[model samples]
Target: MLELGENPDTAYQKIKQLFVHLNLPERLWSLSPTTFSGGEKQRVNIARALSVDYPILLLDEPTSALDETNSKAVIQLLQERQAKGSALIGIFHDEHVKNQLCTRELTFGD
Candidate 1:
């Protein structure tokens, strides 16, 4: 963001959308993550990662711990990122989700 002349603080405000999409209660914002539940922490992890504009992202089972609704939300956010030309490399054990998000597949031991 600095290279693009974008203020990191202002750009980081995107986290609001992330938290909303990931179903994190706004109250989680003021509290320490150590006190959060596993699911909440996982949602935070997803939100934190998506808050930045990295050229390449490496993900491993991003939605593995989420419910169907949350998983769909994550997929929608990822699709939007992909549409904006972000490169996503991930391990998706869920074939349904894999089909939804992946355009090209790199398989091993096939």
Candidate 2:
């Protein structure tokens, strides 16, 4: 992790811990690029992105294919990021997802 406040060592440790917290030990190493389910693959994607430690995270319909439980987990991870002073920009079509996660809404139209 190379973000402003996170040390690489600490970020790596946290990421490892998150994998455990998410109960994804088996999926962590065996996820094939073409064989992952949406939620499982999303977890891996989030892990990779967090490894970068960017101040802002942009997600495009991150939970689109996830079940309720997995979506909640991802939301919790976003909240953690917010607490760390990182900004998250998530693109989602699910009303429940936006309503639960965003403080303000941005709408667009043609």
List per-candidate RMSD values in Å.
Answer: 2.6, 3.4
Maximum-TM-score candidate: 1
Candidate that scores best on lDDT: 1
lDDT of 2 by residue, 27-59 (tens): 556556467666676777777776665799888
State in Å the error of residue 46, model 2.
1.2
**Which pairs clash in the backbone of model 2?**
none
Candidate-wise lDDT, in order: 0.85, 0.74
Per-residue CA lDDT of model 1 for 1-110, tens digit only, reads 35567687776677777898789988888899999987788889887777777887888998888889998998898888899999999998899899998889988876
Candidate 2 lDDT for residue 89: 85
Lowest lDDT sum, 10 consecutive residues, model 2, at 21-30
* Regions more than 4 Å wrong, model 1: 1-12
Q: What C-alpha lDDT does candidate 2 achieve relative to the native structure?
A: 0.74
